[model samples]
Target: MSDPTTQLTVLFMPESAHGPTNQCIGIGKVLLDRGHKVVFAAERSWEGKLAPLGFVEALVDLAPPDPGATDEAAGQFWIDFINETSPEFRKPTLEQLASFVQPTYQALIDGARYAEPQLKAIIEEHRPDVLVEDNVVAFPALVTSGAPFVRIVSCNPLEIRGPGIAPVFSGYAAADPSGWEPFLAEFDRTHQETWEAFNAWVQEQGAPPLPARDFVHTSEVANLYVFPEELDYTDARPLGATWHRMDSSLRETDAEWEMPDSFAARPEGAALIYLSLGSLGGADIELLQRLIDVLGTTEHRVVVSMGPRADEIRLTANMVGDAIVPQTKIIPQVDLVITHGGNNTTTESLHFGKPMIVLPLFWDQYDNAQRVDETGYGVRLSTYGFTDDELLGAVERLLADTELRARAAATGEAIRSRGGLRVGADVIERVGLDHVRGRG
Candidate 1:
């Protein structure tokens, strides 16, 4: 429980992306409800978005604007990068280490380095009691600012390695470690120089050194990852006392959604499915169109969150879509989901008891997709190579599987009833307050 009396000023620095920022919003709401101050530190592109939600927005640019660029949004640099390297996503994960992962980390490292001076300035300006970050890389200024800091792992929990566990980015199965060595070899080969340079720089700024193969430093005070109990991998490798698992951290802030009259007017009992590739995945118009064509032939009605290229793509007669949808609101109303296995969508689907056909594109998405498939909560198919039947069949089968649906419902009830939102908020409150008092 929160003190409800001691109102601590807290600063949140999330990677300027929707997934991590959304997770922060969920927990931030809890703090707001309890009368604590919550502030979100982000780049200028994100200024207007957070302030409306009652969070104090502290905007700091990671880099100056490009000479010719006009439109701006959170993680715009990454959005452009992902689109430019879309072809690399088609390659095997092993091959991607050199082509994609290394460069991605390099960009993140550059951003972190450039933002350090600004981060230091922000800390001085805000003088927060606690600082929290939901990011893949470390920001030394947050740790060195003399405030208690918390780490939120909104990615797959496997990102945190342990004994007997598979390597972080590899989608290899836990029951079999045969593939782990090659993946680690590739990761180290591609990232060792980059990691060492960043690690050295991090230590120079008075923060702890990152582990050999990791980018972010674990918080000594508290660390939290979003994952349900049934799906967590603690049996293989535990993160010990300071770490906690949040079954799901879904926000309550999404606008209410209702089935469009076109779909609502359909005869009762018609199956409804949602197709979303997330922001990055949605930019692949060709792939989205192919999926839409196949799903159009089914007896199902579809709703699509089409990302940035929605205007360029054609939709089927049975489909309605937008560049973005009220995803949390839409999930509960759908029987099935065709998703890119992004962390937010995967956890949200499980939280709503909706079965999924996961098409993983890159990063920990592969991990989420494989876990859902192996754990029986959903099915996974290759993003680039699945045949129309392979895609449609998974949808048909999941929709027909009463046992799986029942298990999903029960799991979702447990996840919902316990309220991971509240759990996350409570842990943060306790950790922040305790650490601050200990310092005193």
Candidate 2:
């Protein structure tokens, strides 16, 4: 039970992507159970979802309304953009800095500007004691809300950098610094102008300036980042006092998933693999089709997350999937995971004690792939270039390696025992309580 005087009206503003929204939901639910009032200031597309989870939904759209359309819901701007730019995924990560990275950050900056006024209105109305944002880019409205602010890095912890550490978005190996300079040079070449302009805009609006080399501002009260402890870069880069690490804040609300009959009917002892490229990566029909074709030939049954364009790809006889599925519920039941190496999936597979074949597409996906591969927690495969033999061999090799499986299981055990959700809730609640009492 929460203290009567400590009850907080907390607002969570997460990125529209499923990973950040879901991570925030995990921590929000815990705070709700502790007698705090939790509210989510999300985009209009999330209308019916958050309310059912017992949160007060404050809807805001990142793009302007269309005059003619019945549903002028603006979140589709990102989905459409990703699909249109799918060709850039084939480029080397360094080259993609100009094509994919800059454009993506530009969109985020535009979104922050568009949503600021609406967010200001919501903050005024709700008067939350604490504000939390799970995003790569910072929003000035959140920082200047006169409440304790928290930042959740649902992406790879490499987003927070140190001098000797590898650059954030580069997919460079953890053990090597050879490529760091070139990647940093490329990142700056493409990102410096936009980042500086955004930072200036933030300060002009009365918010603290963003940290150097970071697009998001670190919270002075409390900041939490999600990544399994075993795979963290603590030895190389130690964080400050305000920083806290949560293994993964997996939502506890997902309904228990029963394996479909097709998978259940597979021959005994056959390995089961879960394939998801996330909502955005899943947009690439050609890539998904290629993966489906290769996995179809295998004896093992597969469960695929078809993503936003599920209908475009037909699953093989040994597989079953829909546009949306219970990822957390299913991860525990699968023997292996083939993922796009999104932070959520990478940490989640670890939390469930499952090994992965990290097929990173872009952004920090490369960093995650390298981290897992080098740590022996998983294998990293080429997303666009993996051959049938490479895919088939990885599956066979991972399933056959008992020692690696045991190590992954052990890491999962430690992470689950740590309970990142509860820890994050505690920190958030403390920050909220302390601030309300003028102690923060």
Alpha carbon lDDT of residue 345, candidate 1?
A: 94
Off by over 4 Å in 2: 68-79
Clashing pairs in 2: none
> TM-score for all predictions?
0.97, 0.96
The total number of steric clashes, by the backbone 3 Å criterion, in model 1 comes to 0
Error of 2 at 397 (Å): 0.1
Tens digits of per-residue lDDT, candidate 2, 260-347, equal: 7777777876889999998788877788889999999999999999977776788988898888888999999999999999998998
Q: Candidate 1, residues 161-240: lDDT per residue as tens digits?
A: 87787777677787899999889988989999999999999999999999878999898888889988878898888778
The Cα local distance difference test for each model comes to 0.87, 0.88
On a 0 to 100 scale, what is the lDDT of residue 89 in model 2? 81
Taking all chains together, the TM-score of candidate 2 against the true structure is: 0.96
Query: What is the alpha-carbon lDDT of model 1 when measured against the actual structure?
Result: 0.87
